[model samples]
Target chain A: MTDISAQDFHDALVAHKLIIPVGVPGAFGRGPVFEDVLRRFGDLVTEAAKNDTAEHMLFPPVIARRVFEKSDYLESFPQLAGTIFSFMGNDTQHREMMNCVHEGKPWGQYQQMTDVVLAPAACYPIYPQLTGTLPENGRLVDVQNWVFRHEPSPEPTRMQSFRIREMVRAGRPEQVADWRDMWLERGLSLLRRLGLPAEPETASDPFFGRGGRMLAANQRMQKLKFEVLVPVLSTAKQTAVCSFNYHQDHFGLLFDIKTADGQVAHTACLGFGLERVTMALFRHHGYVPAEWPAEVRKVLWP
Target chain B: MTDISAQDFHDALVAHKLIIPVGVPGAFGRGPVFEDVLRRFGDLVTEAAKNDTAEHMLFPPVIARRVFEKSDYLESFPQLAGTIFSFMGNDTQHREMMNCVHEGKPWGQYQQMTDVVLAPAACYPIYPQLTGTLPENGRLVDVQNWVFRHEPSPEPTRMQSFRIREMVRAGRPEQVADWRDMWLERGLSLLRRLGLPAEPETASDPFFGRGGRMLAANQRMQKLKFEVLVPVLSTAKQTAVCSFNYHQDHFGLLFDIKTADGQVAHTACLGFGLERVTMALFRHHGYVPAEWPAEVRKVLWP
Candidate 1:
């Protein structure tokens, strides 16, 4: 269990000048130290995944609304999705929107949906692009992109917008599963090498409502989602710093992805919540990077 | 004017396998080559700004709604802004929302405004942070973050969400203006060194409506905004790959940022649209980095 409270962590971040709050509760502008640590951490992650032979890719934060609609995100996690709204009104309607904004009324009513939506996950855009038959051995991709979720809290770890470094694989069932398992071990070892006490446990997404509870239970029962946990805020309530998920042909069917043998492809991904990992580092180690354990410093800075 | 039509660029992007459109018209998933080039470009920008002594920073794409409201974005460029909307309804409202989504009706009505909004520019979050008093010399910050704009277009250069690499300075009026001018020259030279035919000219933001026209004219009349143009899609029209702006205390007044002399600090910034620059490189050179001019390759790849 970590001895740090949420307030303590927040104060340390502010005092060390690592983060600047933009008067928004969960949003922040990170300082040089924070960016330095994040870049080094990303480099380490890249170093670890070099053997995976993953194709590196980059993506914008927003996705096409049509592609998003096809992802079934609206059905699974409507509560946490952020849809981009724009005012498409004519001059008169624009006047109404302006009036509402000036008068502090419900101005959102005048806004209409646009073609783009904020991406819920970094890998969402990747799967759609792989909608055809793969090579004989299938494919692996490494992506680092910003992701959005609507959870606004003062915990510092749960940011409204964050980056996720993900390795997504699509191949035969055995191949995909093996890759996921291999990364799980590799990920745990990497964090342990950094002196972070991490443990892998079965987990589930924050699914919506009553039906979602059953979906969550089924997901956990199948052990399809596993998260590497670290005690950031509390010992009993650990934060998930990394997650490994096996979609098991769900995406293959949606995107029509298939192996060379014409069988539906199996997909899995390992995601590291960059902000949470950084916060966990600050929580266990000192807020100042220089004060961290010598071994950890050597692993990261060296 | 370059003879490349929008379709020609799109076809070339696909032919070179640099980008994959994910069944969406404008949104794309970049490949390894694109990522490599973008990373190298970012490093070059960092190298160019080494003398500025700017503190590098990172920010989340979503910002506090209050901060965004205070920026007067709704009053100036509401057409290009995107507000994050999430489902905040009760279970009853959730059911209705589900019904609307299932029935193919507009269901955005169920979302309530969170404390956050999508950031329109990389520099918007920096001003509110420097709200108090600056040191004697004021401050300089380097920011590279993904920004969102609501423009939906078939033109490949205009992405809905893209990355912007920016250097922001806050100080006395003369100091800020000088920095902007110096950077304008520096930016043009850097692009020219890369074998890009670049030119700097007075520019203006795409302000909205009748009143916005005057605001834009006034901004241009004051010689406040300048952009480096390169012929990416068309030599006839060209594209603004980089921009330099002197805010002349506009942000200082809004954020209450003051200099050591007890006067409002003047602000300036130089912004390079990462995707635009990369696209410009591909356009001026060849689509393949290996086939690019040796001098350009050495500058970018070295």
Candidate 2:
């Protein structure tokens, strides 16, 4: 773990008046300082990706349940998924639900499943959207959106809901892999330029259950996933401020995405967790944005 | 009805390649052009609010279930609420759920209600965050976020999920009401500057069922809600692009927010439905951003 504790970060955020904690764990309302940093970080990322000519896209936080079902997400990480439930009950059932809530009893049973799911990743919606034949050069999309995960931790970096800025590329195998590698270097350099000490290493998703261990091992062995770590809450256990992932043909095959040459498209994405990166910057420099290192301020605010 | 049919607008979007339908009805993945316009719209709103000196805030799209319950949302608009549900099943129940999905059966029964709920409005999260005592000058927050409503329609303006850019103010009743009125005129002027025809009129939220009809009428009669409407989907029934609401200590009583003088804080909020505004812009000034009127283009892009 890092030298700074989660509690320290929390207290610092509260003390600086950068964040207001709701009574619920892991949820917060960010004040101007935090919002300023986050916005500047997003702008910097956008600036860095300017030359890529990636198609900028915005997706709703909640996605169609059918699209999510086709993502094969439930097989790997069911625990992290959130499904939207609605009250389809008649007046009698509604009254019963109210009474149950009034009596401090479970009323969820009265809610029925809706055709929506909270987006598990920033890039999840893009795959199904690219289900048709690609152009001769394939495509790249820049996405920034709120992503949801079920993990509720006191660690400020590990929020249940957070923003991710992602660049997703779909092309031939070599093209996708090369893009991932190029972005990995660029991402590290970019972080360093912003005055943050970041290092990239092979990583794996936090898959669930017995079968997931094998998947994680396979992912690591193939080096399909890499993360840029920064010392946030602890030095020993650095947080992943960014991740580079090569999905290869997994999504293309699922979505029936084919190149102009009629071959299955390969995919890669680089994702920067906005909140974690902001937190890392604050931890490394200071809570005051104006007082941050001159070079860092120049890079971010310029 | 609008001069342009919904079909016509849909065709224009597809023809311009500004949006891609994701098989799910009424849900879409916006492309670069749409994203650009949306971002510019957000910036304009930010610029408009600059003199208001509102603190910029960012909130997670999902909020605590208890906060939602305490907000008395179900009593008025339960039909529009989206509750987050998760599988809290044991191994056997998990297997059963999987089997049910495999067999195309309803498996939501296996899922339990989580501690979170999808935020129905961009301003909803701000109320609970301001629960404690207010500062001497009170507080004003500018929030832009994704919000969910259960209504799914072919009309582009009535999306199940959309972005709401909101400015919420809390203080004495006169302070809140005056701010609302000021913002109302400012919002209308800003939209007019964008070359969109807009008018302000008394409006009400779509409350639920029989009791809700009465509530909506009361809201309209008391002039508690007003909306800035522009003809997008229908000329006869103009769409509400921005809404101004005075909550007259309703949220204060719920969240225990008190002014420095120990009086309950009156709250008011102005919300602009970002997607609807963008839609209105396209409807009024053609779909091509580049070909828009010089004044409008300068106002938005400059």
Q: i-RMS, every candidate? A: 1.6, 1.5
Model 1 CA deviation exceeding 4 Å by range: none
- Model 1, position A243, has a per-residue lDDT of 96
Looking at candidate 1, what is the lDDT of residue B242?
94
| DockQ values per model | 0.72, 0.66
Range of the 10 consecutive residues with the lowest summed lDDT in candidate 2 chain B: B18-27
Q: How is the predicted docking of candidate 1 categorized under the CAPRI scheme?
A: medium
Score each candidate by Cα lDDT: 0.85, 0.85
lDDT of 1: 0.85
lDDT string, candidate 1, B8-111, tens digits: 99789878878777655556778788777877988888888787778777888888877787777888888988988888766677788878877778777787
Off by over 4 Å in 2: none
Error of 1 at A234 (Å): 1.2
